[model samples]
Target chain A: MEFGPHLLLATLEGLVQASVLTLTALGLSLVFGVMRVVNVAHGEFYMLGAVLAWFVTSMIGGSAAIGFMAALIIAPLLVGLLAALADWLVLRRIDYDPERTIVATIGLLYIIQQVTLMTYGPDAHPVAPPFNTRLALPWFEFTDGGLSMYWPWGLSTTSYKLFVIAAAIVTLLALWMLMAKSKLGLILRATQLDGETAQAFGIPVEKVYALVFGMGAALAALGAVLVVPIQQAHYLMGDDPLLLSFIVVIIGGLGSLRGTVVAAILIGMSDGIISVFFTPTLAKILATLLVAMVLVYRPNGLFGAKPA
Target chain B: MKSKTLLSAAPTRRNVLTGLAAAGAATALPNFARYAHAGSDAPIKIGFQVHRTGIGAAYGRWYERTTNAAAKVINDAGGINGRPIGIVAEDDGTDPKRGAEVLEKFANQHGCDIAYGTLFSHVVIGSAPRAAELKLPYFVVSEGHHVASGMLNRYTLQPGITDVKSQVQAMAPFVADNLGKKVTMIYPDFAFGHNHRDFFSEAIAAQGGEVIAKLAIPPTETSFTKYFPQIPRETEVIYHVMVGPSVLTFVKELGEFFGPSHPEIFGFIDSLEAVDFASPGLEFLEGTHFWEGMPRYAQSNQTDADKFYRAAIGIDDKGASLDDPKDVSTYAHMFGCWETLYTIKDGMEASGYKGPADRQSLIEAVEAITDMPEGREHPQGAKLFNGKTHQVFGPQYISKVEGGKLVVQHTTSIEDGLYPDEVDYTAQSF
Candidate 1:
């Protein structure tokens, strides 16, 4: 493969990765933004969503399309409800204390993982995509005669991958609307700004916190459901996504949605592009190094507000 | 004898208490009385160090099932030296540090006669030193080069499975002659992968083939399409071997990247060990070849030994669990657990193993084992055990995917997998 086609393929792969990362990081950012509680169990919620997608699809087996459509709706909703239950049972008792909640969520992480292991077993089971077709991408080249376009070997993406990217965009937009243009959003924002003041103003602060936490986990679950067709559902699958999402959230600016999306694109793209020029292991090292540099220079992150 | 007679005749309070204690022990363990007539009533405890909770859990599940089945077979026919085989299993969590701790627990805490059934190479490498330190004979089913390469201590033996160095080298002749010679290798970036890279490269070079490119994917990578571009255009074959939860994704993405046209692909079945062939994107793998330790799908020429082994493990002809068709067993690798358990039985019987005091003799007995004929005991095939290097040599199978089933294409001779010994483990002190 020529350099042009290679770069093009890498960029496309990066975009697909960035799309999933954006949704996952957005969820992490949302939780920290509103509840002021770092949910270490967020990734397990994502894993649960994928596992549930497999369960739902297998049970409702008619066609891949029908089962997948059903899973898209059911898995996230169930995950959201579970997250709300966890918040009510555990997070509420901790009074959303930052350090204690982190520990609590970590405990929640192990509990969810072990329970899933017992129920789902240890195999990595794949859920078929609703639809998948290989689309061979054409690469442009300048010849002596004129500019030409030809399908380069091994330069292609699947129909399902494109769907994942589009679905992530639509979901992120809806999340934006929910946060920016709704009365519930306004209530949530008020609670986020000052819990005691919002409670005094009859905002139902605890209910808002629980709702925010659920939505955050639901967003992650949504991302997981979309990606499950591409990546199999395994209990340990959550570890990589959790680490990557954390890195994206930190680099994007702790609580900023726009920053999270931008940082996801940056990180995901850099990972893909660097692999083209270097070994995959070196690329990972470089990506982590970039995160370190960013942390050192910008303690508040790119879009994080200075501590009050 | 005189003391025993005196104690029984006197029938004092202490004697009565001792008799009651013996009765309680016999009642609590019913098999105690059955085995007492033969010899020592206590069962031979073999500690199972399993990867029950981490990345290796998928393999661990099948390994446990196979181990249990092998133990039942051994005990039903009268166990090692007439004592029933007792498995004391502990989860290693697939982490090296946890693996070492598990070995300690097996030795001191559980009082196991020997530790066995570690799969991951890193875990075996980490825990084997501790096995040596505790003088516990560690029999690993892990097909890593760590044992044969002389990296591990004398106590650590791989008597069940052939190491990666031998397996990789054995496939070279078929690959160079049948699959094209200009190979591009893609493997995980780790010691296991490095072993494949180095050994295969040398073996292929000996066959007048060259490795065009070597692409090492990071262990944590979930998606792999971007790396496909790095495969040289002139490459005639792509040799890939990957392990982990994301392997399905890796294979699927490779299929999607190449579309209808690609190089002849050869891979280790480790990439799809517990995965089903009927997976969505795996349709593209219909014609590719894989090097299987043991054929996953039962062949038309399948041996009676294989049929018996599969039946014992409760796996169907397709290698899935009998209870659930979707739950595929790690057929290619899990045979090691079955064979290793039997090897332990053979060693104990030969050494006349009585307790932990006989651990050294048991190790010596196993080191003397060489020819293992295909039978109810050694089911995979006839194997030639290297008593010196502490690894086994067996025929390797190459299978091609035809109609979503792996059909055996070629079987290399046991001599094809034999390599010069790197270490004489028997020469080292126990």
Candidate 2:
């Protein structure tokens, strides 16, 4: 098929985009599951991580590698703590109305975006890519003009994409372990299942809830820190992922970890596929509609019900 | 000093108010002309529709500051063809609907002579129709090409850079020659980003290159994984049109994968800041290139303006140089107010109209200004208006962000000024 390279590359693109999508959306799910509240300001958390990476590594006189690494460790942790404080200071007082909580998070989104704009200005940031090395897939050689691909391989993509794929896997695994194996993980799951019951069983549900919320926010920051080399930091950069993550979580079933992951992959792949075959705007419309249909069919989401 | 004062004399419109009726175009719509000045029995109220928030706030706030300063200067001089000027300032908060309400009050009830200032393109789009309906001359600082490219506008004039066409024309060819191997385009799926995409693709293609892919992610999208698959290893350049944290996130993720060895990548420095590249582990940008609307302020001109503005208004001159040879778009925004106000004085003097709040005299004189005078104090030399188009034509420059500062590398000849037209005048309902 003449379109073989396009199809193969499209599939590859889907997997790559899926990696970041899953990591970012997974963070949302864990927080929502544990706290029973959606932190809509999650995108802002991502924005902060990018800004931190940009400033720490590029602005100060230091090794970019070391500085960026330092930012990765510290920025996300700070974001987590800030998220915890927000939960304590603002949302904690009014979790009764989920609608109000949504409004509150929207306000938080505005606050963070404006603060970032005031501090950073409204410009696109170009973070230095990791190694800038290029490894052709040995199948397709791209000339200054057009493209040609060899047998079976049929297409060439960047080797760094593999890094993204690997990172996503590692993050998902680590998160899975934290959820399934650790003490906090167990407490979080118990709280997710039944907060009052978990509190009765002496799990300290409230403390676990706050910690869980903070950790999810940390994941967002982690995603931000990791991706700064790929895209760049900007103030309004969080709205897209915020919207897509909503679609992903709704399709996967809110509060369902495995479902979020699976749904993220599906959403990512669908996006890539749509961009490949149709136009970007059409693809978005389709993906959004797909989420709507899924919601109509399964209000609890595809995998959202509590496991019996 | 007396001779210097004579040499420094500019065109002045002294006490020339209440004379548009002599021209008798007031007779064309005398009744509405009466409505235009319905409550002007008192001092004329001038309102500012400005962005105190969003990306445009930085310049918008500055524009309002300078406008107020200039208006004050005029009042002290003699008060406009000769009524006193009164200003009513409202914050649009950088939102379009809010901008519309602010304009509605200025036009419908407050009876302003002219409503000026807007930062964001979308917000300008949002407020333009309402301003047009009220027949208020809306001077916006937005650079959206749609504003001047035959849209719904009779009253909205954009004196700044045309962000899309000008940036693309200046930079895309250089990018095609320097880093045209494999280019990827990624931007927010908003109007601003979309404009970049359309122009970048056109410019790149005109240079005999093809855009392998154009990625339009939703607003506030931070993840790069899903988008990375489309970025083939063969990509030699990336055209990033994102803002805020996404810039950092995108660059960081790109770095984690490709590091400094990914081909040459460029971004719109105007849409961002010098700090983003210099401070944020953007070593890849060490020899990086960028397109900006402001050139490095020269010491001589900056010192001159500083001395003059400070001597006149007693405010610190925390502004760019009048002689900075940057692109004209932003220069127009930054310095256009000073020029327009000064130009109005000249026009009123030439046409024998007056101000302070001489609304009729100022509008008639401004509408009649065809050629600018000699040795006038304008940032980009002088500004001439196309009376037919009601837009100003000025110069644009090419720039590169070097050593964390913007330096002008080249410039384009003066082109026509643009105003939003009639088809797309709806700046509301956003």
Candidate 3:
């Protein structure tokens, strides 16, 4: 393939990856923003979503479309409820203490992983996409006669991949609206700003914290449900998303949603683009190196607020 | 005068006590010998180092099932040396560090006569040194060339399955002549993948074919479409072999990237071992060929031994679990566990293995084994065990996907997979 088509394909692949990363990072950022708690089990919740999707789809077998549609709604909702339960049972007792919460969530991670292993077994199960069709992409080239467009070999994306990208965008948009325009958003924000003050003002602070944690996990679950059609749901699948989400959240400025989305795009696109120029392993090393450089220069992160 | 008085006073009571004690010792002596004799009849403990928790868990699940099934069969037929086969399994977590620890637990803690059943080359490599140090006969089902490459010690033997070097070399003739001459190789960037890359490259060149490009995907990669662009346009065939949870995604993305038009595709069944062929995006793989260690789907010409083996493991003709059709077994690889367990039985019987003290003789017995014929014992196929290199040579199966089923296209003879010995493990000291 020519350089133009190759870059074009890489960008498209990067965009799909960025779409999922944006949703996952947004969840991690939201939790840290609202509750100041780093939920180490966040990725397990994502894995739970994918696993539940498989369960739901398999149980409600009919047409692939019907099963998928059902999974889209049920998986995330179930994952959200589970996360809320974990918050109530464990995180609530810890009083959302930062260090203790991290440890608690790590414990929660192992519990969820082991339970899933016992129930779902140790195989990677694929969920059928509602619909999938290969769409061959055409690349533009300048010729002696005139500008021409031709379909390049291996330059294509699936319909399901495009759906994942679009679904993530709509979900992220709804999340933005929930945060920026709702009364619940206002209550959550007030609690985030000053928990004691919000409690004094009768904001039900604990309830708000539980809700925020659940919402954060629900967002990640949503991302996972969309990607499950492309990537099979395995217990260990959560590890990569968790690591990538952390890198995105850290590079984007701890709790800044806009920064998280931007950083996701930057990291995700670079992952694809760099692989085009170098080996995939070298590309991963370079990306990790970039994160290190950013950490050294900007301790507060790209969009993180300076210390008061 | 004082001693005489004390002796007279206690002599009656002491004589009675001494007579009772002597009678008790004489009675207990016969019983002690009988108990010692019964101890020798205890089950021969084979410590199974399993990957029950980590990345290899999928393979581990089937490996365990096959091991148990093989053990049951051996025991039912009056086990090795009249002692029942006792499998003492411990999870290695698929990590090399944990693997070594598991081996120690097997040697000292479990008091296993021999340690067996470790897959994943890294885990096998990590734990083999400890097996040598402990003088444990470590029989690995892992098809890694590490054993044959002389990287592991004499105690580590691979008598169940053919190694990657031999398997890869065997595929070259069929791939070059039938599939295509100009190949584009895509494999995981690890030792296992490097084995495929190096061995197949050499083997293909010998057949007057050349590899046009080699795209080594990082093991951590989930999506693979972007890498598809790097495949040279002039490539006649794409040879891919991937392992891990994301393999289905890799194959699916490869299908979506090419859509309708693409070069001939040849791959190792490791990419789709536990995965179902009826998966959504895998429809594009309808005509691609795969190198299977053993045919996943039962063939029309399937041997009676294969039928028996499949029945023993509770796998259906399609290679899925008998209880659940959707849960596919790692048919191509899990056969190693079955065949290896039987090989252990054969070795133990031949060595007249009685206890851990006979472990060296057991290893020696296995090292002398060669030319295993297909039967109820060696089920997958006839194998030629290279006692010197501590690896097995067997026929390699190449199957093509037809109507969402793998149909065997070619079966290479045992000689096709024979390679020169890299190490004389038999010469090494126990």
- The stretch of ten residues in a row with the least summed lDDT in candidate 1 chain B is B30-39
Per residue, candidate 2 scores C-alpha lDDT tens digits across A8-110 of: 7677878877887787898898888777777789888888877877777765535656776687788888888988888888887885257888889889998
For candidate 2, lDDT tens digit of each residue in B248-345?
55554555444435667776654343232334445556556665544433322343543555344333222332333111123324555655556655
Off by over 4 Å in 2: A1-13, A51-61, A89-137, A140-165, A306-308, B1-46, B55-95, B105-112, B119-122, B142-154, B157-333, B345-360, B373-376, B396-430
Please give the lDDT score at residue A85 for candidate 3.
89
Per-residue error at B109 for model 1, in Å? 1.3
Q: Write the per-residue lDDT of candidate 3 for residues B1-430, one digit (tens) a residue.
A: 3354424655667677877899998885422233333576778888999988777888999999999999999899998899887888899988999999999988887777889999888899899999999999999999889999999998999999999989988889999989889999999887788888999999999999999999998765777887888899999999999988788899988988888998999999998888889877788898999999999998998889999999988999999999999889899998899889888888988999999899889889998999899887887789999889999999899999999999999889998888777889888887
* Cα lDDT for residue A89, candidate 2: 81
TM-score of each: 0.93, 0.69, 0.93
Rank order (by DockQ, best first): 1, 3, 2
What's the TM for model 2?
Answer: 0.69
Question: Which 10-residue span in candidate 1 chain A carries the lowest summed lDDT?
Answer: A275-284
> Which pairs of residues clash in candidate 1, taking residues 3 or more apart in a chain or in different chains?
none
Q: lDDT tens string, model 1, A176-198? A: 89889998888877877888999
